[model samples]
Target: MKKAEEVRRLERDRIKNNIVVTSTDAKGKSHEDIIHAEQIGTKIITSELENTAGKERVMKNKHKQLQERIFINNKLTWEEREKRKKMKQRMEEEKKKGRTANMGYQKITIDGKQWK
Candidate 1:
């Protein structure tokens, strides 16, 4: 009985250590509230990643527009610029949304908590 209980305790610890939990407050605020023994390697944070990616996208767009206005726009006629811009806008609107068929998370929930 003692050995079996010890084994179960250890397994529980292992599982707890492998999981991370986040919490949110009522005023639309969120934070990572719990993590049991921290993992050895890098952990990819979803919100931080999205924020960084958004900033990068804005910077890239600004640079592209600047380059186009400084170089390409000067050489092209007004009609040509509007044509290219309209075509890009149409293609952007037609772009696909959401994930591919096979994309998913391999996570599971335990007692209302998520585990990866």
Candidate 2:
């Protein structure tokens, strides 16, 4: 049991240290894509931005904007996807029960106090 727990702990730690890389073109717009390194959890970026060529201010602005768009799009998509799935499931269940009321969802709240 101890060995198994150790393995799970290692796996969790590995996931936490993960890093991502995104490269952009000369215009500061994303060139190809924001690539992600998998299990290695580390990224080595190889791009023109390495030298930060061309106008410093313009390049920086473009890079920042591109990164912001990618970050917001990726974050919201992943985070909200699960909630969307739950909503769909609830709607389906309500349909099956022939209920038309708009219902709020309750996550299984386990109160420590037991019913006597």
Candidate with maximal lDDT? 2
Best TM-score among the predictions, by candidate number: 2
TM-score for candidate 1, residues paired by index: 0.21
- After superposition, the stretches of candidate 2 with alpha carbons farther than 4 Å from their true spots are 19-116
Find the 10 residues in a row with the least total lDDT in model 2. Answer: 70-79
Residue pairs clashing, model 2: none
- RMSD list, candidates in order: 22.2, 12.3
> Tens digit of lDDT per residue, candidate 2, span 12-114?
4443322233433222235433233222223223222222232243334455656444221111233235765676676667667776534333232122322
> Model-by-model lDDT, in order?
0.34, 0.38
- Once all C-alphas are superposed, what RMSD does model 1 give against the true structure? 22.2
